[model samples]
Target: MSTSLDTTRLLAALENVAVISTTDLQGNITYANDLFCKLTGYAREELIGQPHSIVRHPAVPKAVYKDMWDTIKAGDIWTGIIPNVGKGGGVYVVDTTVQPLRDAAGNIDSYISIRRVINDLMQNFEAVEFSKETFDEYYAN
Candidate 1:
């Protein structure tokens, strides 16, 4: 009926899935579904306070983040594919959206990231990995 109801339903439908996580502006693990914990091979206690960078895969470029931040800071949402290295050093790809969380005054306070497994997306890219700058340059318009 309403957006909150829709979100709740979505969460319920996807609760058994294990790849979704929500992070705060500081990159703190604010909320991580069971799938996220299982995928990362970390228990809830170990992840909640940790920065998202804990799972940062070396293959991810810094320039992607540079653009990610620039986009979010400007009050826009960022969507792209991210290849992340798991705790056990396994790599996986996902389509990700990083959105700014704004306060009552419309000031940005945090971020909420929604991700979907995108192994197929990776199959389409000839280059296995991309730098952040490289990604930005290609996507810049």
Candidate 2:
């Protein structure tokens, strides 16, 4: 296949299957894929120009956010299992990877996050109500 065709196919596939969002350097949403919007139960309009934290779940600790910011701000990739709250307050889990997108001048312009739904991988079926206590107990080993 030609390079253009390959690029087209890759984008189509990513659009269909990947939960994707891009945030500006300050963390305002710049773009959101359909899958992301559907998963978060928010429209693209509601997401754009808003902070990416609009979907942040209470169960996530501040330390995690600090770590993620530190990693991505340094032009490194950050990967984690993130639990997000939807428009109606339902919670969902995703295996997420975040990386910086650089401009032509080699300066980091924005961050792109790609995620996969991991609901089936969760042991507890009641993850919608997942809280800090539940998270601690689940990981207590």
Candidate 3:
């Protein structure tokens, strides 16, 4: 049987392992967790106040972002593997989940995203030629 302490410790470890961030309704970064900053090669200050799109790779299909925004704004969760461009053109990929966060009154307030790096998986996908059609299939609910 797991105690509260065990649950707390598990979440703490998970937080450390995950790259996380929160963005306000306007899509500007509100919080950049340490792992997010480290993985993206950006200082926390550089990320904060910037659009969350700052990390998006140019080649990422626009439809993907559109779908993600539509899903999260409607208070649903969106999950997919995303290719991201880091500071100075560095590249990385993450299995990402973005969801809306609610305020005390149960109104949507902001969005929180949690991601796990999947560089190897993305590399394999790229080797097979990831395409717009494939992306659309992934975006399908």
Q: Could you tell which candidate, 2 or 3, scores higher by TM-score?
A: 2
Better of 2 and 3 by lDDT: 2
- Per-residue error for 76 in candidate 3, Å, reads 0.6
Per lDDT, what order, best first? 2, 3, 1
Per-prediction RMSD in angstroms?
6.0, 6.3, 5.0
The true-versus-predicted C-alpha distance at residue 39 of model 1, in Å, is 1.2
Candidate 1, superposed: residue stretches over 4 Å from native: 1-7, 16-18, 120-141
lDDT per residue, candidate 2, 1-141, as tens digits?
A: 544667778899989988999999999999999999998889999999999999999879999999999999999999999899999998988999999999999999999999998887686656645676687888995
User: What is the Cα-based TM-score of model 1?
Assistant: 0.74
- The positional error of residue 130 in candidate 2, measured at the CA in angstroms, is 23
Please identify model 3 stretches exceeding 4 Å from their true place. 6-8, 123-141
Candidate 2 clashing pairs? Answer: none
The clash tally of candidate 1 reads 5
lDDT of 1 by residue, 1-141 (tens): 544667777777777643767677777888877877777788888889799888888878899989998998888999988888768887877788888888899898888777777776567565545555588888996
Query: Judged by TM-score, which candidate is best?
Result: 2
